[model samples]
Target: MKFLLTSGGIMNKSIHDALVGMLGKPIADCNALCIPTAMYGHPWVGPGVKAWEFISGKEENPMVNLGWKSVGVLELTALPSIDENRWKPLIQETDVLLVSGGDALYLCHWMRQSGMADLLLSLNAVYVGMSAGSMVMAPNIGEYFVGWTPPDGSDVTLGLVDFSIFPHLDHEMLPGNTLAAAQRWASGMRGPAYAMDDQTAIKVIDGVVEVVSEGHWKLFKP
Candidate 1:
């Protein structure tokens, strides 16, 4: 699987270009599925208008709003009740998966429960993740970002990537997300980590990772 991990969803031309490059086609020609499960788990974002906005392409993030050939919702929380045969093929056939931001641990839980986590490694489609969506790919989100804890009550995530991520770095609205805060977060990670602004994204294809940014980012290594 290919990854286009962003703090914000394709917020800038560089990130957009990286996504297009990964697709190997124009956005208008591809079919997409937007996963809005994470939003429901977040206290500040869910069970209301916010989820509707993300699905309807009314959110500030440039995700579902992208002109795709088709866009469908793949709510992870609801997948357990349905038959796998009904949804597995749909995922395999989709060109990309647009994942929304919320609680990383919550998203990780559903991803596991829904079997999306297992299926992801075998897919050929691109994955576009925003904020928590991106962080869920890391080995761990660190204690600072933990919310909606799993059964084991650990900060661990999917570990799809080798490094962790500190998203929305220094955003005016999230004053606690300063570089210093990210550095402190990284110290606890005990591994490689990235601090990225909204205009930045990390691209991973065939195990090679590259930073695609129009804003600022820093990489901290243990």
Candidate 2:
């Protein structure tokens, strides 16, 4: 899986340029499978899809738009409907699973409930993530900073990658707290743990990890 973890929305042209640098070549050739898992706001309908439309250049928005064909749209916030067994086949067909930015905790919860989390780690496709989409893939969602409170009852996620990915490190949160908190969290892990800043990505091919991007990636080992 090739992950593009960015800091917050693609609100600026430079960030968009970075994203385009990674995904532009691949997405430009095929109809991509875009899954905006993070944008789970109430009246959970538009935020996720709209963000993707802008990135894929299927629509116009001031944010990053890459002009890729969006073949599928899955709003994980819609929960149980997305969890059914029938949807697995569809999820399997996509050339790449692109996850857009939103609430990390909420995205994790919805992915767990919908069974998409497990499906993703096991699937044989490119997994692209931005912001919260990046965090949910980690061993823990870093709730202390992201404020991941379950709807009074559930706290579940697939825990796919055994690392705590620091989404948007260059531009989100106080740098000291973000790094210190992340380092503290990584110190306790039994396996490899990483906190990557924006424009940085860790590529995993058949489970072998290699850093690939334009920023810094710090690996913390206890």
Report the error of model 1 at residue 80, Å: 0.8
Model 2 alpha-carbon drift over 4 Å, by segment: 1-25, 41-64, 82-86, 151-156, 172-178, 188-191
TM-scores of the candidates are 0.99, 0.70
- The most accurate candidate by lDDT is 1
Model 1 earns a TM-score of: 0.99
Residue-level lDDT of model 1, residues 1-222, one tens digit each, is 999999999998999999999999999999999999889889999979999999999999999998999999999998999999999999999999999999999999999999999999899899999999999999999999987979999999999999999999999999999999999999999689999999999999987999999999999999
lDDT of each: 0.95, 0.58
RMSD of each: 0.6, 5.0
Clashing pairs in 2: 7-168, 55-66, 56-67, 56-68, 57-67
